[model samples]
Target chain A: MTGAPQDPADAEACPVAPTLWLRLEADGTYRVGLTTTAARRAGAIVHYRGPVAGRAYAAREPAASLESEKWVEHLALPLPGTVVEVNPLPTADPGLLNRDPEGAGWLCRVLAGPTDGRAAPPSVPTGAPE
Target chain B: MSLEPSDEARPGRLPSWRLLDLGRCAPARAQAFVEAVAVSVGEGRVPNTLVLAQPSAPYLSLGFHQSFHEELDPGFLERRRIPVLRRVEGGGTTYLDPDQWFFQLAYRDEGGGRGGPEDLKRFLRGPVAAARSLGLSAELRAPSDLVVGGRKVSGNAGGDWEGAHLVVGGFLLGADVRAMADALRLPHPALRPLLRGLVAREVTSWEEAVGVRPPWERFRQALASAIATEGRFEARTGAPTPAEEARFLEETLPRHSDPAWRELPPAPRRAGSLVRRLRIAGPHGLLVFRGSGEHLAAIVDGDRLVEAYRVGDGPTDALEELGEDGDGRAAVAELVASTPSFA
Candidate 1:
């Protein structure tokens, strides 16, 4: 978890969830991306339905969805916050979602409030998910 | 993105499922009802439930993340009067008929870092157990499948919808491989034969797997029992609460049947792309055609394009630029041009 802001805080898969990777920018905005393991387990990434910018999602509430040939997964941010921006590349180009999930395929930018009812979960271990 | 296993997640089971055995129904009704139950359970208005249903007739359904135009030939369905309903669960396009027995479940998402290979096996344990009871040597396959004697016996999908974890799957009592493949939109003319053959080798039905097709009643009962026991649910057979019923009749049903929902972009449209994506099932991936007033970008967005097949030209029309390869694009273009409000 290099360059992590505080900690990753998604509700669906953690107390120390590996489902999403979070990074903090200098402006207090958080960059969120799906972890590689979650992407691989989803099989082939075919479609992405991300949150509408400006919509507020409670901690763990699904902020986006990733669809594969066999399954569909609703994605949630680790901390409760409002989505400030969403990357449009993955929605148009589904390949990046699988090939560079934590890098170029980052999902959204969220701004978390101090008392958003949920705290950041611990950082994903350096070894990460297989 | 640690894909490693952890023992920290609390072991919790899904709540008891109130079994709603709608004896037989129109395909849309079955889809709508499952959605109703999911919304109710997710919203905490109704108990967690398992639905047993059979469509009275044949129909086509698209998964939530599937673009209707991408996966199917709409005019073909319209001419045949085949109804298409888009379900919330994400998967590939599916063909449903009375010969298949459908089961859907919805429960409170007791979040504990689920959705790994092991979690998929855990979720499908009941179905695997149920299939074996019917005398097929069924086993749970990794990443969402139930196979019997090496052929897939069921199609299942899982996801969070309306705040609840929903699981949907079905047992094929009989399969019409040709119809199943034909119902889909193909990117190239050459793939038709391959399509049917591919489907035949991959899927199996009860009639094909076992010596005889067990009576639907017998199989349905077995499914309910296995699911209840394995899911740790009591299996109370009943109906949705009044609120759930109201939402179904008013909200869910209408939305399922609405053309707007059926034709929605499986994925959100690219920012600034004018017209909706005109997509078709290519041999290797999704072939997408996005055309605005004058510009059209043809790209296969998913897997690499193994081979390029050009759709030379179509009849002169608003969307004819999409080209005609004797597949179905020409027909789709004509349909789109004639319709006053083409997406």
Candidate 2:
């Protein structure tokens, strides 16, 4: 169930929800962030409530809630894993999601589970990470 | 155009759509109907539709995530007998009545792949053009607001429901600014004049923006025509099916009327939570500061300070430098020290 590498130059993305990108780091953690398209669609994110560090969320379960002036959306990790770190930048200045969504606006980093690389499009479950 | 199948067919091989004009419905029914259409379109049971509705009675509509306790004055609402209902869409609280015309456009996701902002801009162009056709200069502002002469004439809210893209906005033909001010709980009692002034500066109605107020029916026809022409859809008049109406009665009505939905979830208590109120001397006049948690909001009389610069959310390095003791007076002093003196 590994996601096909869409871009050989960078991170692999879920075809269903191209807005979500997962990059596997050297330490076996997948750094996850919303693509610019997702960020723009969500509007200006004014608040972020988390996938707490050390907490493991199941696949399709909400990992974080992003609130904008006009909408609130729940974003889930494509693969279930223990959250290693959560970005503090968005909590301080939620505008970063719109200003620099792909870079500094990374939502959280999760320790890779056995099946962390699979594509879990927002529409369908790609099975929980082992 | 007649209701015949051939007449209903759209010209230019475009999709034909319905325009449901549910004129002057009860407050609860108005909310229910919009939700019904959104659900129907999302499920692909209904055609891409445009709905026009107006509440027969005055009521306060709360945005989906807004807390009723924090946003509205309950006593005022109770005394006035104005029912407060929470909408499924996200936006700030609004007071609605027959004087305003409400429009909602629901579309099946066509894979256009545009973001919310772009979608909103595209949806608004029709209304803006309709306003312009009436000889009023109107423009769409970012994040879904329609304005004339830089003052908002329409406020919009939108989101994806089920699988349908729903955008709802209202045009204020006439509004009671004073009643709107009294309905909301401002930070201080002394801020009423300030609120009125702010509203006067920011909001304009159709009658005020244009010289004459066209009849609501005329406005609706103009808007529908403009939208159909711009979006390339033939507008056919129709109503919700029996199943959709049943769904609204059984499901949407009860969910929106639930009392618990009006309140925000309780925030977790944190240790060392500082709540402070302090009065500081400002360049224009006395400024009152209310600081709590990581955010601070200030109130000041006069137009000297631009509205945007008056509020600060989350403490900055300057506030942290005041000391770890979290003294209210000390924080005020530190803030005043950094603020430039207005001579």
Q: Write the per-residue lDDT of candidate 1 for residues B1-343, one digit (tens) a residue.
A: 1111242232563444578888688887766577777766766666677888889998888877777786786555876678888777766778889988888877774422244334445667888888889887778655566777657777777776555667788888888777887787754443445456556766788888886887878888988999888777657677767777776887777777677767765554544422323222211122333333233323332333222222322323222233346544453444333322201
Query: By summed lDDT, which 10 consecutive residues of candidate 2 chain B come out lowest?
Result: B274-283
**lDDT per model vs. reference:** 0.64, 0.63
**What TM-score does the first chain of candidate 1 have?**
0.75
Q: Across all candidates, what is each one's fraction of true contacts kept?
A: 0.49, 0.24
In candidate 2 the C-alpha lDDT for residue B332 amounts to 53
lDDT string for model 2 (B1-343, tens) is 2234454354556566778888889887765577677667756677778888888988888765455776786667878888788765666678887788888887766422232545677778889988898877889866677888867788887765544566788888887767766677655454545556556666788989886787878888989988777776778888888877887787667666666645533222122322221111111223334555333323332323332112344223222222324464345545544443322
- Evaluated with lDDT, which candidate comes out highest? 1
Task: List pairs with backbone clashes in candidate 2.
Answer: none
Q: Where's the lowest-lDDT run of ten residues in candidate 1 chain B?
A: B1-10
Candidate number achieving the greatest DockQ relative to the actual structure: 1
Question: What is residue A46's positional error in candidate 1, in angstroms?
Answer: 4.3
